[model samples]
Target: MEQSGNQNITDYDLIKGSIAGDPRIQEILYQRFAPKMYAICLRYAGNNDDAQDLLQEGFIKVFRNLEKFRNEGSFEGWLRRVFVNTSIEHYRRKVHLNSISEKEEVGIEDVSVSVLDQLAERDIVQLVQELSPGYRAVFNLYVIEGYSHKEIGEILGISEGTSKSQLARAKSILQKKVAEHLGVTRK
Candidate 1:
């Protein structure tokens, strides 16, 4: 596929080029989506190195499965889903979500909404990264990716209640981190 004069390349073209093993199109596809996909990977990966690994693994899967795409919806959405699932798979291998006993649960007071309002997105992402892998996985799935507790449970191999509990703890810990970052004590 030759780059025509002054016309933006469609994702269909990119996918086609990539399937044909055109390095130029593969490189173009990577250049187009890597940043957004890497951000998603970073939310689930604990650190930069792991995030890069997820990015690499995800793109590998994306290229390998590009032919499976049915053209039913957004290409970017499909790519995002692949990246998120790759991150989840990475977390799944590293940590098992052992159910926490109720007696060990910690309570956290809800902070003012302004706390999140005050923080930059990078600050919020950093706080999320500070979470343990189990908490981070649930938090990313439910909170960021908009998967429900039931869906998250199925994906992570935990019960729905456990999914909810992890999200609660993740939120609670995040609130404290945000409070500390903002120099405001949570009551």
Candidate 2:
């Protein structure tokens, strides 16, 4: 599809152009999605440097595999999944793999309330960054990305128990942070 002078190029057009090695269209796609995807990386990375690294790596993968995007779902969703998986892959590469005992994993219950909702997205991101890599990965996958422990374990190359344990620890840490922010403690 030729780029019209006045009309915004659709995502499909950019994807097609990118796959055909059109650098301008590729740049257009990158500018369109990079900001949103960077936020995803930041949530998983715990810092700007790591998030920037993941952002670059994820875009590299996206461009390399753009032809494989089957058009079955929203292109943005597909890109977000790729970035999220890329973050997990990076985490696994850096962290030691270990099995966690069942007893150590905490059970997650649906809370009637969410303090995180009260905080700005940036503040929530900062709070999540305070967690260790393992805990942060599990938390982002399970809490933010809506992955199950089993799915997270498979992605991170850990047992389901380990994923659960890490998520529990992350929640505990986050809960304390939230409590501090609220000027209260868990009863």
Candidate 3:
């Protein structure tokens, strides 16, 4: 795992070196992916300290299970799944997903895409972070990670109805937050 004069080592080599316990290669692998992975963690964890913990836990899982990674897809894709699952596990431990009452499940108005398009990426992340854990998990899994409500229910140990409800609730709250951020009144 010695560094060649050129800094363009491939992921295959990095994986092999890391699996073989090469410290330099492990560090390189971590440096290459940590930033993007941390964003995933922050999206799920909603704060710096929890995100940091999830990131560390995710890398540990990544390194421990590196040998299980077949070369079928991009390494970063695999890494994303790991971090996202780690974040979900953390969420599960911290909060129990409960079904909202019928009275509380109001119809959600569609937030205009233009309002979302106007905000900075950080503002969007901040707004998402403000969501409660159940709402946040469902939103990230459904909207961000592209999981169906059924899949999200299986992952989060809730019913599919609950998953859909949580996502609707998350969107409703985010709609309000976006309007407030844009200083627009909702009729």
Top model number, TM-score: 3
Report every candidate's CA lDDT: 0.86, 0.84, 0.88
Q: List the residue pairs that clash in candidate 2.
A: none
User: Candidate 3 on 1-187: residue-level lDDT in tens?
Assistant: 3345326988999899999999988998988888999999999986989999999999999999999999989999999999999999999899987667655655543333457888999999999999999999999998899999999989999877777788877888888899999999989
Compute each candidate's TM-score over C-alphas.
Answer: 0.91, 0.87, 0.92
Say which prediction, candidate 2 or candidate 3, comes out ahead on lDDT.
3
When 1 and 3 are scored with lDDT, the better candidate is 3
- Per-residue CA lDDT of model 2 for 1-187, tens digit only, reads 3335514788889899999999988888888899999999999886899999999999999999999999999999999999998998898788764456666455554233278778787888998999888888888888889999999878888888787677767787787797787787688
Order by TM-score, highest first? 3, 1, 2
What would the per-residue lDDT of candidate 1 be over residues 1-187, giving only the tens digit for each residue?
A: 2345313878999999999999988988898888999999999988999999999999999999999999988999999989988998898888888578655544433333347878899998899899999988998898789999999989999877778788888888888898899898756
Best-to-worst order by lDDT is 3, 1, 2
Off by over 4 Å in 2: 1-7, 97-100, 106-113, 185-187
Return model 1's CA RMSD, one decimal: 2.9
RMSD of candidates 1 onward, in order: 2.9, 3.3, 2.6
Error at 143, model 2, angstroms = 1.2
